[model samples]
Target: MAMRDASTQTEATGPLVQFARFDNGKLRLFSAHTHELRYFAISHVWGDIGWRKIPGIDGEFLVSAQKVDFIVNQLPDLVGDTPFWMDTLTVDQRNQAEVIATVQNIPAIFRDAGKTIAVRENDGFYACCADAIRDARSIEEFRNQMFEHCEIHKDHVQEETYLKRLWTLQEILLSDTVQFVAIRGGNMDPIRPFSRMISTIHPLEVLGASFFENISFDCVLVFSKAYVMQEVILRLPAPLRTRRDSIYNDLFPMVHAASNRRASKPRDYIFATMPQFPWYHYPKNAERMEFGDIFLDYWEQASKNGFLSACKMKASMIEPQVRRDLGKSWLPSEIQPEPACLGDFLKLLGGQLPGKSAHTGTNIHVTRPVCISPFEYDHPSDIIEFIARMTQRSHFRFCLSCSTGEIPKDQGLKNIPWENNLKDINMLDWLQDVLGQNQSVLPFDSQAGNEIFSNDMRSQGASQANHFHPDELEVARDYLYTIFFYKNANPTEDNAWWPGVRDSLCRLFEIAPASHRLLPILLLMTATICCGMPVSATAWLMRFFIPIHVQFGEISHIGLLARHENLQGHPTPRTMLCVGQHLPVAPLLAGEGLHETFFPIPRRHDPKRNVCFGQELVLIDPEDRAPIGLLPDILHADMDEHELWTNIKILYDEIAEDGIRIVPLSDL
Candidate 1:
């Protein structure tokens, strides 16, 4: 039996594809389009370094002598004379144009094939293991025998030869039916489905955990890649032949799996996974394109989920400056993007992706932002206290978004009764009382720490404050989970949330007297504000800061950073644009009159104004008379009840004296 290259017509028609079968003891090769013929596709590790010319009747086909011998001697019996397609003979790799055109179609070839049989050339370890487990009585006995065989064959390969290559993922995943075969005792053992071989691993993992110690550990589980490939393939929704569109949703997981696998060519890493995406097409000039450019191009065209997922991937070198120049400051530069793990991949799929979408060639327009004047601070502690106080204020607003059963229909801020003097009510204590005692307040299981935190926050022990009640402990625990776990979507990145807070607390405590008690409470309040409800748009809005450098100019850029991400340094006055809004809790207020009308108030347009718990008012500079900032048109509960009416009167007077001018700020 002999093989030949695909015909010129076949290469030109679509993807370079050919099928071979033994007719009357002679191997014959014929050309055909995808899905036009019923063929068994062969996926195998190429036995040679690079493509070599194999002499044939009409032209030289791309296949090595080693692979040719295996196909002619073994493939015929494996597929039982059903015409088969393998990359070596099917692809005319000698032609560069044909290689590019057919690279993507390889997956479809395997996918559309009647069956796929992976040939493990020159591998006898699987045969020994199969024979060892054949006569076993129980799963435990089978597991021990397998481990014993592995111990004996320590020098032999620990993993299947076929599964070692990076390109096998696509070959295994896309195929409808797949089985592993090799030269077992000069003839093939009964061909086992890929799943059947994978099934042997669970007994050892589940029931024979201790059996690993008895044998050379690496040898005991010979086909670990099989387990990994099984997991990767199983993640895909079934019936991929009919529903190729479903693969888009599982793009990140496939990418994550691909990162573990490797290809000889750098571009093959991206090309191998391209088939999973039906919408994406490999660039015509893909051979010349850098890996990063190709990667960005692929993800940019991906579904919204995939595009965002790529942005979050961990990379050694990220081009923030390049991204900024590209007008997509939100996206990182040239990353060798890799998701941390399978769990992280699923988290991106299930959890909320990064918010405040700033795409390429777009202005970051920040609407209704509050601007303030620069103030001199003697110490960094002042900044911590400043940030902590602002965090508390933000938390107060965050509570407005949450609704609970305890609050009456008339009440605006539910469950917790916030008083008129907002300064007196501690936001953390309120959250502790509401969420801890009333377990049913949130939709998710509040008590289940593992459900939320991959790293259990409850294990962090008591809060920094020494004397805290059990309920306070519980709140602190859940609060840490809400903050650290959710904020750092990529687990590999440093958990920057607590360290930043700890440093701030340390600086603040150096000056303040009662530092012991204040640390935990302030920390809780900070986390509450930074990561409000994981899914809330209001929570999303809170993370953004409109940087006002000189403290007296039109806002240009709005920066959004995850609190848990490592902070290079403290955001100086130039970067810290403190903007906030008041919660409209007027409906919940026991009494109403002039307060019922939620309108903007007129205060002395003072310079160097800090964020305060005031009603609808965008503080402006009276002396400069500059258009300072914008605020949401809503009433806050903290202002003095009488002061509210006085501001209203002053607002009317100011309106008459100086007609309010609406000036638009330049686009960011």
Candidate 2:
């Protein structure tokens, strides 16, 4: 029978439950009001066996006599004669109103009950393992023996089907006192406490498929059941059992966990987890508010405020290679054919899965510093490509010119390509022609106006190779030197000039040799040196071209570069997150950031509203620190690079304390 809709039921009192009590040679059924909150609840997988008519019960929907005997015999020892609620008996199958009422309050039934006894009907392996390992003294000894037993009797291992049911996720998560028991051969076996089970089996289970070589598939399946059971226990609030307040932190994890679960009815996939939302209430008219709208309303509230904590924890835990694969701009929409689980997403990212945790919020209150750096790229694409090149996968190499860190380094520039017309000449000869002693660097000679850098500018932002006549050298060198020296040396550096030149370079070379854009920068540096131009010119331009830097506390090194898209004002800075902690497996923001966009996601509260994704924010190294200035010109011409870095650092630290401002993303 269908359950009654909200209008017929009071949300606070909820549906009435038929509780079964076994007395002296008799079993009696009595209805209990939910508000009394006295009965314990039973959560188990319903078997395929036909119903058995209890002598006094007046219905065909009665559960099997074996299950009734298992409950009557074993449940008393756990809860001591406490009346319990089971769906088959407690929910009226013949009445539609009672069914709807009971279904709507499924979450509350488990949550409000005095205790929840999770019954494993088929599996006897746990009982066998417990009996065999009863003599073990230490956890190590228990685990070793447990693994051995699982292997020896792998053929008989049965996975806990209760853990795989979609409805049971909430049943176990919402329950305060969840006791697991297995009914085997008309006997009951009490499962050990979650703490001991996790300590005993988690290490081997984490080894995953590799650990299954010596172990049988049945054994692996049983261990996986233990893993899922452990996952539910981990999500529950500890010390104090009921934490209605922490549901926001767990919402996304619940959704992801449900991906692996099975539901009898398709809509039950959504309905089962509905009670986990703290904002959810039993509606007066279930037909009035479509489930889609109700879910979107919940998603909107949850997506914006709570997930930063989980994102930060995941960011801190993931590896360096995974972070690089994301390359900063990865929003969830970018991944082709959405991933099903965290492991699937990590697999798609081409990285190893990290050690499993609940991925809950760390509750650390931190903030993201939003200070601007003087080094602005012409377009986001320029920086994206440059960062992509630094990775082991990309071909761009900086050689020895990179001062920020020694990376993308190779013995003196290897792949600098010359223009198509000059390809016949060796690169050395080409350089000599352009910068030889008698030659004047190309410049504006109105009559035969030479455009030596026109091809370079078109192909690479501000840097490209072009054939030049000896007479064209003077104007080209002078023009190059003016733009370089003025922008680098000007007390009031006009950040706008480079961005314009950078965009022009991108537009020109978008269709050029995709891999060789950086070649022109190196070629230009070589030209400056061959022509007896100042050595400082090469150093100055290198700083601008590779503007990004990263550090882990005092250790200055190249780690990962992320472009912050929240640009404001001139001289937009790409804020570098310096993780003093070990390298994380996922980019702090982008990994779960994809989940945020796609939906089905699952962090900590900051009373001050200053929580950030990563752990620490250290000062950038002075030796390699790039000059960063906020808009409206914060620097004076006389200021030294060290002093400019110091002032900017003070602001960085201050802004970090203020925290990042979270703007809710648009609906997916």
Candidate 3:
């Protein structure tokens, strides 16, 4: 290219660097900071053919396809007298020093440009949407005109490769005005103001039908709103965009939305998004920063700024992936792709506790310091097996006591063993005490039985007449009668009868509200597992199922546990469960020389078998003096193993609650 000097200048005494202007038949460079330069920046994908040398610019490069079409056919008419910035022709990508400098200057280049032209080689849908958007007078009118066209092209819209690219987010956001170029017919669509699009189109309406159907509608709505908000920030003037508080709130959702998008280089995921954060300092040796190092820097900064909570909350929503390892205890993983809203994620984690703040909002609150502790488990499979065995044993013992009319009347059933060995003398002593009382067995319709059933029906929401079919009620009633009276009257000694009793009891536990003592026992057992104590200790503790109070220095309202073995090389380990406070209690071991860390529960069939072995537990820390928020206080109740396991499973599957998988004993 030939160089030419111009009069206008912004600052500095140095010679203004040359920028190529591809107008007319001439190839000439003008001072980037001079000549009152009004340029449109070109953002397009670099295809496989790579860079080719342009004849007039020495060995300096231009993208091969751009030399053939973009400059020759599309630019002259569209840009007219204005100079345009096309990286391929303007920057010497072959020169490492020049490449680094250009990369660092990208934010300024895009921001200063009069407009950004996005060149896509696709046809149909985008062209149609562009035309409709260009003609609409109002957002509602735009929506009305585009809705049917969007539906017809929904598949094409969803499958658009351009939308899935990471750099495109910054390219479109930094520009004041953007024009879409469809290369199919060399059509340059009308320029649409970037800020206007943000205000006009609802993100949900842009979602294709298939994509829309896969997520919860409410979640889609929430995410759609968040998308618009992020766009609004991106369109802000540079100074406002750089404000620490304003940008920090948008980072979580922006990161989440970008997770599934493509990055040619792994580290580009971080670098490409950096333009959105004006506060980010591009490293001196920007290209040398490794992905892990970049992520660590981000984590440290986010934690210091209190953005880590939002990151953690987003991390709780998705499953863990093997390749990406942003797994520090506090850092959220970008490896796991989440398509739903934060509200939906919380619902998936066992529906947020009734009154608790969901923590999905953008407002940054003072986060209390959380104590991290390792849960004791050699393998997740081991915990899974233990849960199964303990659950079966507990179910057996509970059924035996109920069948023999040994359950106490006033305080409900108590002192049930966690073991299955029926020959223990304590069982005989319990049986003798029941026999000596000579308590009269009441009919099923008696006031006490009526009261028990009524309470159960209320808890189960079966009190409403329409809740269950007539036949379902008969099944429930028959099972209750057999366990409560028939089995007691018959007094069978057959070993074969045990299976029926266990099955009947499991069903009863499912429909009936567990006895008052059951919840506390369950809570204690969960806490024991979280503390990394022996399983046998938990079993022994079951004998004293009376009102038990657990104390910890600080407690995690929710936590996850996975085998430390699986997390050896991972920078951030997946958590197993979002253990609510009170139930899963672990000691605060920070600065106490405890290097052990817990991971989230891996999916059962996850190839990472070493991590998936145990029954997951949720625990609390006693030392934390921070406000508990909405964590439920541990209830005082005697719970059978079956009831305890069931509640554990319920909590494990709660929406947005991370980790903690409950594998059924029968399945094991």
Identify the candidate with maximal TM-score. Answer: 1
* TM-score, structure 2 vs. true: 0.39
Query: Residue 450 of model 3: what lDDT?
Result: 42
Ranking by TM-score: 1, 3, 2
Candidate 2 residue 39 Cα shift, in angstroms, is 2.2
Give a tens-digit lDDT track for model 3, residues 572-591: 32222223321121222224
lDDT, model 1: 0.39
Clash number for every model? Answer: 1, 26, 62
Model 1 per-residue lDDT tens digits across residues 363-400: 11121333332222224344344443333334333333
- Write down the TM-score for model 1: 0.44
Q: Any residue pairs clashing in model 1, and if so which?
A: 319-333
Better of 1 and 3 by lDDT: 1
- Residue-level lDDT for 598 in candidate 3: 32
Over 207-278, each residue of candidate 2 has an lDDT whose tens digit, in order, gives 222223223444444434443232222223323223233332322331231133456542344456554554
Please list the residue runs of candidate 3 whose C-alpha ends up more than 4 Å from where it truly belongs after superposition.
1-18, 30-37, 53-67, 124-158, 186-239, 243-246, 250-259, 301-562, 565-668
TM-score of every candidate relative to the true structure: 0.44, 0.39, 0.42
**Candidate 2 segments exceeding 4 Å error:** 1-16, 22-29, 35-37, 49-56, 62-82, 94-100, 124-126, 136-139, 186-246, 250-259, 282-294, 300-668
